[model samples]
Target: MNTAAQPPVGEKVRCLACGEVFDASISVCPVCGASGEWLALYVPETNAFRRESEEIFLIVGGGIAAVSAAEAIRERNRLCSIVLFSEEAVLPYNRPMLTKAMFDSLAEEALAIHPRSWYEEHGIYLMLSKRVVSLLPEERELVTDDGAHFHYDKCILATGASCFIPPIEGTGLAGVVAIRSVTDAAAAARRAEAGQNAVVIGGGVLGLEAAWALKKAGCHVTVLENSPRLMMRNLDAAASALLQAAVEESGVAVVYSAQTDKINGTETVESVTLRDGTVLPADLVVVSCGVRANTALAQSAGIETGRAVVVDEHMETNLRGVYACGDCAEFRGVNRAVWPVAAEMGACAGANAAGEAAVYAEHPVPFTF
Candidate 1:
């Protein structure tokens, strides 16, 4: 039941896990290693921060999907009131760069997809650090975490998926992390010390990229993939083997069919134990299994969801004025959870919402090892 605001710039934020208070300047709790998401933000006593919105088009989420949809809507209708809500405090950036450039010191300006001025120029109201807590499709109303209600002519549920961390023992340790957002990458970077042992669970693209980042940061990296082959969803056995060899050549050990039973450590991760009694020493563990579509808000409002929010070719949900797109939506029983697919879906949803005829066709792009 925690709200979005808390831990103001200089205030002490309390950690829900361990009740430890720390400065808001640090995104992660130094006492228990919990990320900023677990810590509450500081909110003032006044209701001045409460936003009253009646946008013509309301988009939930600030990722690429939401941005694309906003642009499409504006392209179709210039004077439409478009409001975008983002759970993160910053502007939408290239999310893929978080893994690709983890070792590099990237400025916020470099990571942003569109500068702050760009949103204003395009007439898109970007509400940062705000989460839509509930959706009332019956009333065409949306409620944010801060208790602000908004009515929209049409709404897009583009809330993206979050990193899925398996229920593994010792995962709460200080060195354990996930590389999902810029904040996550920064937390992982802070722990990737020289000569440290880093274990990356799941040999998917995100995991491999994280392992490479740690390797470049001078950490001895090992990739543990539970399946018999790495990137099993996309790569064949031969391609998987070739990719494993290349990763090994870069001084990273790739282990297949490795079931991690537990992360062995008291407070900080010391090593990882496999099901076969094999133990790999580790100072950091990055879990990059996959993502679960963010469908809680839609489901709470009685929207049908099976793995993801159900949508038609027009990207409209069961409700007349509500639409869903990106990773949070499924069409004809298929949910293509990739950047390219998300962009296409966003465009289709935006166009159709703006009274234009648009249909989302499946774009099949095979995964490359």
Candidate 2:
């Protein structure tokens, strides 16, 4: 775990009112008897109940879902020794801030969800920059990138997604960037500079975000979409129109239904060629078209996979003692790969992975606000 990513030291845990030194799991303030916004989530299956909790291991991919799930499980099963592992070098940080970090150096402290110290204080064993390579669901064992093995009463797969790259001529050209994680953001920010002209592929949320970052970098940004409208999957035509107008107001150029044929550049991406014989000039290109579930690792381990890792509403896979969630898992064909569903799915999977019966609920759609 990165020590810099931990929570602030000596953050007082006081009741909302009366300011009592309370030490009980009461939703209402112990002294004031008022229910304030104190988020202490729990799962009874893995928890010790009247005694202690069952020790569990949580394997996370890059995203907030795993973090949310880990917190929920940690609060309830205080006795459980949680081993938090991430493939990313950084500890659990606010991943959404990656877009902002692309153009500006967002403080590391501000991005971190819990610093290394916070995990230590909470008694969680943090394995930063570690990857879980194999899952032995039958033996309840798992292997890491270094061939280290650990047995779990249960396991979770929050492997998230991979950057979707469409096959096109000259797609391999350099300066073709993808913004999926903090590492990607940092790299893009360095590659992209002010006064550069950037062409962005995809009209999804991430594409728009990348355009914003590029604009802030003083680049003239143009967005090219294969779809007829932006955010077609998430929003209706009316909402898309409003969002398009709002983004256009920000000085972003939008090209609708652009079928890209190839990238143009001898050594690096200098422009994009469309199927209609139109060329969009650029100094750099960023792709945020969409994401596909990262199920290769799971597939290698012989776990069942559908469009994604096939899991039930409870986040359980076909195999016992193994669970999947977040962007990687498909629950009853529900693939709302946003924060809310991923968080709920990951939390449910983590709690149940500790030898407890935990069922997940269907998440709601994002509100059109």
Cα deviation of 66, candidate 1, in Å: 0.3
Candidate 1, residue 131: how far the Cα is off, in Å: 0.8
**What CA root-mean-square deviation does each model show from the true structure?**
13.7, 7.7
Clashes in each model (backbone N, CA, C under 3 Å)? 5, 6
- Structure candidate 1, residue pairs in collision: 5-41, 6-41, 6-42, 7-41, 7-42
Error of 2 at 50 (Å): 6.1
> lDDT of each structure?
0.83, 0.73
Model 2 lDDT per residue over 1-65, tens place: 65544324433344433232222333443222345464232223344523256766656564666
In model 2, the runs with Cα more than 4 Å from the true position are: 1-58, 367-369
Q: Least lDDT summed over 10 consecutive residues: which range in candidate 2? A: 16-25
TM-score of each: 0.83, 0.82
